[model samples]
Target: MRQTGAVDPTLPPGWPAAVRPPGAPDWEHTAVAWLFDLVPPDYRAHEVLRRYPVLLARFARDHVAAGLEAARAGWRTVRVELADDLPADAMEAAITAYEREGARLASAARGVEAVAGALRGERWVPRL
Candidate 1:
């Protein structure tokens, strides 16, 4: 069993540094803030999200997953879709941008999943 106060080195990549380990005090508040960042600014206007964080985490997860998928699709077709409008160099840059955004969205997706699990009272345990 892990100590309550120990830093969790086993947290998966993309876990927000701002959120304390599960079972720590006020971790959910920090998680809500981080989760809000992943979603659209308009989401902040919803009082329900503030009142119910687990629901917010679900929304964030869906939003980030969709973004990742869109980035992948964009990267795959940007060249052919925009070839007539963009110069060769510009097309290369667009592809690079899509690649970078896809990576970022992928990381956000992982982070949101971890946060959602934590919000649902799940704890990570280390195995020998």
Candidate 2:
């Protein structure tokens, strides 16, 4: 197993670094810092995540999980009912587009989950 006290080396520079408590490396703050590059300066989500990372984490876990489930269901529908009326290759195109968008949303959700993990105050490292 990887060392819990070690920060994930894969994390880009300036990501919130965490280690064991007594000083758990302030890793939770990294999630907020990480968002700046992904979103606009005035984005309201940034403010909420920055000020209340734990809450943001919980909200993300709850809502994003649901959204992903719904997305999966919709994707299933698209796969099952291939369209004869729509443009040729439309199903493939739609799946590709959905995969791209879903990956982005999943990345954001993972960020909040990472922040929540940090809040737990155990020896911290990113799960590979």
Top TM-score prediction, candidate number: 1
TM-score of 2: 0.54
Candidate 1, 10-49: lDDT as tens digits? 7754577767666678878888988999899999999999
Candidate 1, residue 107: Cα displacement in angstroms equals 0.4
Please write out the lDDT profile of model 2 over residues 45-85, one tens digit for every residue.
45665687565556556766676676666677776676764
Backbone clashes counted, model 1: 0
Go through the candidates in order and give the C-alpha RMSD of each one to the true structure: 4.4, 7.0
- Each candidate: what lDDT? 0.84, 0.55
Candidate 1, after superposition: displacement of residue 64 in Å?
0.5
- Please give the distance, in angstroms, between residue 53's alpha carbon in candidate 2 and its true position after superposition: 2.0
**Residue 21's C-alpha lDDT in candidate 2?**
28
The residue ranges of model 2 lying beyond 4 angstroms of the native Cα positions read: 1-7, 10-30, 33-51, 80-85, 125-128
